[model samples]
Target: MDTAVTSTPKPVALITGASRGLGAAIARELAPTHDLLLGARSADSLRPILDELPGATGWPVELTDYRAVAAASASIARLDVLVHNAGIADLGTIAESSVDQWRNTLEANLIAVAELTRVLLPALRAADGHVVLINSGAGLRAHAGWASYAASKFGLRAFGDALRLEEQSLRVTSIHPGRIDTDMQREIRAHEGRDYRAEDFLTASTVAAAVRNAVDTPRDAHPTEIVLRPF
Candidate 1:
């Protein structure tokens, strides 16, 4: 036998909102096991993750830009994992919420996710990939001041449910994690006019690990929905 070596291809994982906070943590967690494609608003936004995970590539494309997302998806012939972690939280009671706010929330959280997933179906099908939707507790129970955010998350929950039912060859998991200790949480707390306590929220690493667990689970086991809370 000749002295030759065959390199094993690593699984591919693309994570949005991966520049900082929970997305970055997820990127770090999956870096060892997957070939990461970190997505953010701009290539510059992904620089931090690129620095953290040397093997990861920065994929800058606005998730809402259908044309851009489609073009990006076209290049992904085989995707092992697609983690939808990008979203916005605009806190306002239903009465105080504006039409624009609702539209923006839905557009960022639900529509973009749907569109991205739709375009990536072929790549996902080719690899029998996993889709992880980083939902929130708001997705399950709406709070008073989180109308727009909750509605978007609720819509996301429905989207994931439908996708799971439709994509027979792929695995879909809607991770409804409670408030994580991230910049987003800081903003939400500011909206509440309260002091930020890191202990009160779950860690980003914890949530990332949960996502990894879902992805690494045996193919025979389907992790449809997983709820994680701080307590």
Candidate 2:
């Protein structure tokens, strides 16, 4: 019914770890306006979300695979929004945590993020895009048992900070939110020997809204860092 000869193309937004949890929530929030690129570890995992959201493509790849990420960036000529939402939290005290856990956490949370952003810089620069890092409350302050995860998030915060300083044209943000009612939280609760309490945590939708708000903010102003605590 609505036929304009040359309509402006919608801005493209790519969200990693978008198969579920906060990543899926972000995809839903942006679906109304943006051309979404839903990224996940497996295409099968993305089937459900792709079915629910029209016109969104599922990009399945290992973030740690530098070659694959480089190739994926090539397909995206212009990226308006890039969300670093894929991360793993290894919760344990320094004494209890192994070297492998620390390495794995840093590899996924910080190194991969940096690598992806580096590869995508050309596309982001073409659009003057915004980069959003989904950091944790632990990023601001490390908890006793969450040393390894906190370290990785803290590193992520630093990465965003440095990116903001180095790239004058791009907007970089670090979002620090408290524990959300996610499957990841359930796994954390099991490790802590506590009952899963969904009511006591932030919902993914709420956090996703915060992300959308930042993206919608006026270009004249930059929302550098946003922190969200459960209410």
Candidate 3:
């Protein structure tokens, strides 16, 4: 009789907005090595991919709700990585954008992520985990129609930076992924201009690979920020 028992993986990652696009790509990239806990608005959209991954679990979550995020955190035993990638972009001049649109964008892009990080910090601290904030070039610079989106991302970047200082023992990375070929980019093109070349956009897979690299790096060495711009 063979009594050998296989050991489970050590590092575990929890990623928000894992249904599709950059989030999905990141989840796929990490699925091979880490146990992934994916959260998105719809379980139906996440199930297909989650089923394919060996060590993964999916939870349908509306990130804007603080209670829901807190509930999700309670279920997680330990976490080695937290990817705050759930965000909504609203493009328009400050005057042109509706009040509701601005509020919704801020709620999803900034406030919710902040709340989730607050709830999950204990677990992350225990594991000495890495926290990856999916930021944008807009966070670093201002653009014409990026009033709301840019403001939200800029706030998030500030939060990530401050949090990094607070948690000196943990790794914090804020990545500004430029022009990814995702639905978000398509929306930008539709509202902004079609003159921008899709070919120049970075693939979600590329951003995903970068995320995995950050997670796999040595604990002592931490890359504070990385800006990936496609040529």
Candidate 4:
């Protein structure tokens, strides 16, 4: 008889828009237990986070470029977690919006996400992975001047719901967070002509922690949706 011990391989997680903000925070939170694939539009953009997390690899590909996304995702034979955090907020009322604005917004936020998830379904299924969508409160409600952005998020939430039903082995989580304090929030405030107050919005770390919690939940219980708001 012989006795031997071998370490299990760490689970793999891929986070889009991981160059900064909530994506990076979630990467940091999962680094200890999982090998990370940090995705951004360009390698240059991913350099900083890749440097911060030496164990992470850069996955540079524009999500809307379906050819590039398919090629890029081919290398992953198995994936434990997939976080859809990349999205555009091209806010405008229906009257003010253009064909191009609506097309671009949906292309980036909804279609691209669907394409990525479709391509990665095999890999995710292999690992019985978890999918996390970083949605906004706009997903739950539409506000004036936010038609396009809100539509994309609402679609995202619907997508998550569909995926949960379709992929019974995989866990799908939609994190619907209120305004978050980040550079994006600042820009949104500037567009609204309002003051940028960090206290008024949720912190990136807090949202990331919520993601970590969903990912860490026991296998017996599925974490389907997590709604977050600032105090």
What tens-digit string does per-residue lDDT give for candidate 2 at 10-79?
A: 9999999999999999999999999999999999999999999968999999999999888877888899
Alpha-carbon shift of residue 25 in model 4 (angstroms):
0.7
In candidate 3, list every pair of residues with a backbone clash.
Answer: none
Residue range 103-206, candidate 4, lDDT tens digits: 99989999999999999999999999999999989999999999999999999999999999999999999999999998889999999999988999999999
Where's the lowest-lDDT run of ten residues in candidate 4? 85-94
| lDDT per residue as tens, model 3, 65-166 | 778778878977678999989898878887798989889888888899889888988898888888999999999997988888899999999999999999
Better of 2 and 3 by TM-score: 2
TM-score of each: 0.98, 0.97, 0.93, 0.98
Q: List the residue pairs that clash in candidate 2.
A: none
- Give the Å shift of residue 201 in candidate 1: 0.7
Clashes of 4: 0
Local accuracy of candidate 1 as per-residue lDDT tens digits, 22-132 = 999999899999999999999887876788788899889999999999888788999999999999998888899899999999999999999999998999999999999
Error of 1 at 45 (Å): 1.4
Q: Which stretches of candidate 2 lie over 4 Å from their true place?
A: 1-4
